[model samples]
Target chain A: MIVADKKPIEEIIESVKEFKKILILGCNECVTVCEAGGKKEVGILASALRMFFLNQGKDVKIDEQTLERQCDHEYLEEIRDVVDQYEAILSLACGVGVQFTAEKYHSTPILPGVNTCFLGATEQRGLWTERCQACGSCILAFTGGICPVSRCAKRLLNGPCGGSSKGKCEISKDVDCAWQLIIDRLKALGKLDEYEKVQPIKNWSTDRAGGPRRVVREDVAL
Target chain B: MLAEMEPPKGVDISVMMENASRVKGEIDAFVVPEMSNAVMRMSALGGALLLQKNGMDTVMQVCCRDRNRLALQADLLAAGASGVKHIMVVTGEDPGFGDHHQAKAVYDLTLLELLDAIEKMENGHDMSGIDLCGSPQFLVGSTVNAGLSAQALESELSEMNQKIKSGVDFFITPPLFDIASIKPFLSCVDLSKTPIIPTVLLLKSLGMARYMARNVKHVHIPDELVRRIQNAPDKARECVNIAAETVHAIKEHGFSGVCISTIGWEDKVPDILKNIS
Candidate 1:
């Protein structure tokens, strides 16, 4: 999921101090699961900001709307009719949602209420740790479902470099070595030998290096 | 600069330390706990937790809708052990308003009954009437929201006063978005001895203010601050700075202290606290 943290309220207040008619766009994807940007989050933020604005003696108008998925164009197109009417948009989505809102609403300014962190899954309440780099590929199969791209400081395909010791990353002792995780997983799957078998370097062209990527499945084509 | 924040100047520190030194003096912040966790979501829970963890000396909020009396009692015990210091009682919002639409709700105890039970527990009896090996000493608090309906508000306050008589140490309020929101209710404050900590909702975004204006019944968002948020170059930060500024205003208005309630935008609380101190 697209992990994010709500932009500090003070920072959010600073971003939209100029606009009266505002729309806070919430996303239902990663931000929602991570408890950063969601329908409820948008509602709460709207209420709190309204109270703050009222206290400051400023007249503020806010419209709260949550999208099924802000990163998708179809979800963003839903608010097309009214997007022009608002002075600005407060996107409670990740960076992708903010950009999507910005792209869709060229005439209106779209602001971010959340700081887009990397892709992650929720470990539990109030804890979200990064998991994938989304480098336009999935190498989880070879690494036992753990993405070395995000977990390892160096995205080594077959790792446990000399720097990794005692299953701890050399950089931060507090963090477990991603390579060690890979080894544990591979061991569990009886593929510990696979790590020893060095794989060839990946093709950078298929990743973000080549620019925007699109998926077209002929079976599902429009 | 990682924001060099020391305990303000000597005079300020002295006054602040003096205030801090009164920890045992029986004064409580009495901020409203978000009773409707599933209805309001964990952001509300997260917000309250952050405040208590960050040193607001906050109260733990527990409502009856999400859990049965067992869950409520367990969480109550958890909050007590977590150093939350206080607990607020509420018969939470209905589950129909929540995402778990089809989920069943268990309301084993009403707000007043919950208070009585807590009081009994505080006096060292378990809710089951059995002697517990250990029990926590908690300052039990309750909420006081001026209902959108006038008569309901009056009856609620009277009922709340009754709760206070049954060992509610203090009372916290629903968001006081505007002065008018609190004024009419303050004129009717019937409780004596127990301090009332009026809550000020910190609106951190212009869009948020307008959302409350339309959706939240009883809460009114003023036009002026919205206009300022509309005019500021950075609206989100402006929304929050204005909120921090509001905390100052609320403190200045002679309320006990501001109950920092912005959950999603809690980073602003430190800023608000910085300015308030």
Candidate 2:
């Protein structure tokens, strides 16, 4: 899921200060799961903004609404009639959602209320760890389900670099060395021979190095 | 024949200069490490240039951990312009091991790509395919880890082949105390075609030897050598003697050369080389 974190209340306030009427938008997707942007978070932000404005003796109107999923056109169109009523919309969604909402609404300013972190999983309630870098090319089959591109500090294909010691990265004792995990997994699975094969230089063209990417699916096109 | 000299952490190069001058005529070329162990220090290029200015040959080590492709290319061109000839590439230790733990690692190019970029610049074009003002020629070298296990050794050999294809002039292995330990690596890689220089690290103490043997993967410090250091009356002198003996053994085996690494004890390097000659 796309993990995100809520922007500091002060920064959000600074961004939406000039507007007499503002709407705090939230998404019911990944951000909601990560507890960054959701219906409950929308209410909390709206209350905080209202109290902040009340203390300043301002007559600012703050409204709150959460879409099923901001990335989808149908959910975003649900706010079409009321979007123009507010001076600005604070999107508590991932960067993609904010951009999509901006493209659909075009006129009103779409401000991001949460910082989109990465494509990761919730390890526990509060702990989220990154899982993939969307490098476009995947080599998990050879690496025993570990993703070096996202996990390794150096992003080394042929790893664990000399820095790996005692199953931890040289960077930190807290972080588990990704290559160590790969080697151990391979060893356990009796696939240590896979590790003997030297991985060639990765073709990063499929990655962000190739520049802004787009997928054209003729079969799925409407 | 090579000695590893780490650049000083601060501005003062008095100790570094003095150490290099001590063994000036003793060794072939001083291999100046670039902030080795991810510790911040004077840039390797700067250290190499200073040594070169003093009429000494130096192999400047470049790591892909810190700089992007542009910065790397710029530094390479700078090294060329400054007349520092030999270049050794390494995938440096992670920044977490260094003082600056919060710094971001910019590995824009893999080791092979960086080598390819160096080759490209030598061919009179930058990584972007733009023509260079002038090409910088260098004796390119890189490090290889000859693992303890057969599987790991095979993997290293395969990568060594790739690095050779990338035009690496020489290869350096991790510190080796026992020649028998690297027998697997020795049998697999032919020394004549591509020169392999094994590092002879001067163990600071029995604790360091034990720590490296247990903690540092890929490095194999023989039990007998560790016990030898343990039983010595003077540990430091014993460490130096062990280094000298390893260098002599490596020479006897008819390998290309040996790189003597003193860690921070560059002062003891003179003593290590004294017995070698």
**Using TM-score as the measure, which candidate wins?**
2
Model 1 compared with the native: what TM-score? 0.45
lDDT of 2 by residue, A83-174 (tens): 88999999999999999999999899999999999999999999999989998879999999999999999998887789978999999998
**Per-residue lDDT tens digits of candidate 1, residues A1-222?**
778887889999999988999999898887888888999999999999899899999999998999899878898889998988899999988888789779878999998898888878888999888887777768887888888878988767767677988999999898789989888988999888878777667644445533466888999877
Looking at every candidate separately, what fraction of the true A–B Cα contacts under 8 Å does it contain?
0.00, 0.00
lDDT of 1 at A199: 65
C-alpha lDDT score of every prediction, in listed order: 0.70, 0.90
> For candidate 1, what is the DockQ?
0.01
TM-score of chain B of each: 0.74, 0.97
Off by over 4 Å in 2: A1-222
CA displacement after TM-score superposition, residue B49 of candidate 1 (Å): 8.9
Instruction: For candidate 1, give the lDDT.
Output: 0.70
Best by DockQ: 2
Q: Model 2 - which docking category?
A: incorrect
Candidate 2 per-residue C-alpha lDDT over B204-238 given as tens digits, one digit per residue, 9 for 90 to 100? 99999999999988788889889999999999999
